[model samples]
Target: MDETLREQQLRMTRFIRDPHANLPPPGIEARRLAVYRQLFLGNVQGLLAGSFPVLRATLANDLWQSLVEDFYACHRCRTPLFTEVAGEWVGYLESREDLPGWVAELAHYEWIETVLLLSDSTDPAHEPEGDLFNGVPLLSSLAMPLAYVWPVSQIGPGHVPQKAPGEPTLLLARRGADQKVYFSRLAPLAYALLVSLREQQISGREHLETLAELAGMEWDVLEPQATALLLDLKAQGVVLGTYSG
Candidate 1:
């Protein structure tokens, strides 16, 4: 690109991104610049509104608009793709200090659905009906166990908690065979088990034994309950069955 033309493009982009702080490209009419500004911001806002409907609805209109505008103007996104804008917005929210503590958590909670829905990754080779205890248990590639300080699953316009609760929220977000994403609150034990499954390629029996030790319970005592939990998870599509490879 020619240096002069490159400079012109940069100036226009700055003006479109942050119109109030930037002067419109030298000879462009104010009306034309306004149109460009509105078009650009409107597109971004529409994309984000769809991505974070809960966050948008939870905040007051002015606050939401200001937040979006600040993100648009001040945050330089690493990706040029519109599909990744929500992730970028979440990253931006996590970096800000002035916002409420739950804001970033809620945004991340909302963004997870988008991430799972659009992910191109596929499940690894596994036996959907294999014995989970005898072979390595397979966790679904789309199943994610998340822990947050705020009750992000319950936060909304009418129910925003003034402070985080004593216990951190544990939740599982997974994609079903129908291609829809779902979120469920998880018990601490269940959360720990899932986290362990994700981190360790071990048989279900071994995983249960480890959990029993962690909980200070006998393996025989925990086996029945833990086995039931694994069965339920397999039924729910969270567990993809035993690892075949």
Candidate 2:
């Protein structure tokens, strides 16, 4: 709380954030400061690398390191837990304008796996064979519906597409009973229905009827397809069960 101590603390943090730009606080040996700086920065870099493995592989060593440095120096994390660091990194990426178009989407695709793995909630017990039309479909606690401009799931070392496809990518990722996260590509209509199920507490029949009306299709045409899709999702553990009452 002393004036001199406060100034020293500020200088030390600045040095930790950007050691090349700012010198260590007065009377601290450069060797001692270098060790602290390397230890902290290296740990962050390693964590980011572990969190976004495919992103790191796509960008290669130098570009990935530069991106990590920028993230470290610019972002002030809200939570102290290391498990939440990837979310902070994703938020930081969202704010940056100079990153490649697919970078943020790719980072998010990688982050969701960690999010599901660490989630404390479990899927509600429901009959896997429940009817979707007559029942209220319950989504898995660990499942998430994600729509992205780029085909983030397909991007990696050898298959980075420079431009987004004509249609936006739709994906459903869920953690199964085996505790493994799996991703499934979804049709745009199917993705919309899944998102609607999450956002609106409507019966599966009503949800598909609304979607059919919005798309100018009759219930007879959409119902069978929607029912089949829901059944597949239920089998996949994305949709646990449905409530008819």
Candidate 3:
């Protein structure tokens, strides 16, 4: 590329990113550049708005606009696909310190909905059969465990916490057979068990046994409670089926 054209391209991008701060290149009319600026910025803002509607609502207009401008000017998105913009935005929020403490958690809480909605992956090998206790419990492919300190699942227009709790809020978001995504609040132990089931790929009984040992409880006492929890999870479709492996 020619030196002048390269400089023009850089300047054009800079202007588009922060039109309020940077003037358009010398030859280009300010009016035409303003149009381009709006078109570019508006599209990004609209996409992010759709992705994180609650976060946008929680912040005042000026704060939201400044946040979006900062994102546009500073963040270099990893993916080229437009649909992946939300993921990129979440990544950007992970590194920022100026925004509210809940911003990153809330952003990820919102982004997971989009991810589960768009997922096409399936667990066709597992037949929805066998006893959950003896057979290996297969976690729902669509199930995602999120541990956040700010109680992000509870945050919205009505409620926004100023500080994170001492203990993390564990949530499980799962897509059911009906294709609706549901959010379930998990007790710390339940959350750990589900994570262990997924990570260890073991039998439900074994998972619960380990949990019981870790908690210094007798297996007989924990067994009944563990069985009840498993049954509830199965009913909710968060536990898809049992795998014998």
Local distance difference test, per candidate? 0.93, 0.86, 0.86
Pairs clashing within candidate 3: none
Give the better candidate number (1 or 3) by lDDT: 1
TM-scores of all models? Answer: 0.94, 0.91, 0.91
In model 1, the clashing pairs are none
- Candidate 2 residue lDDT tens string, 105-201: 9999999999999999855566566767766788877989999999998899999897889888999898877989988898888898889888876
**Candidate 1, 201: how far from true, in Å?**
0.8
Q: By TM-score, who's the top model here?
A: 1
Candidate 1 is scored at a TM of 0.94
Q: What is candidate 2's local distance difference test score?
A: 0.86
Better of 1 and 2 by lDDT: 1
- Which segments of candidate 2 are over 4 A away from where they belong? 1-3, 122-131, 243-245
Give one clash count per candidate, in the order shown: 0, 0, 0
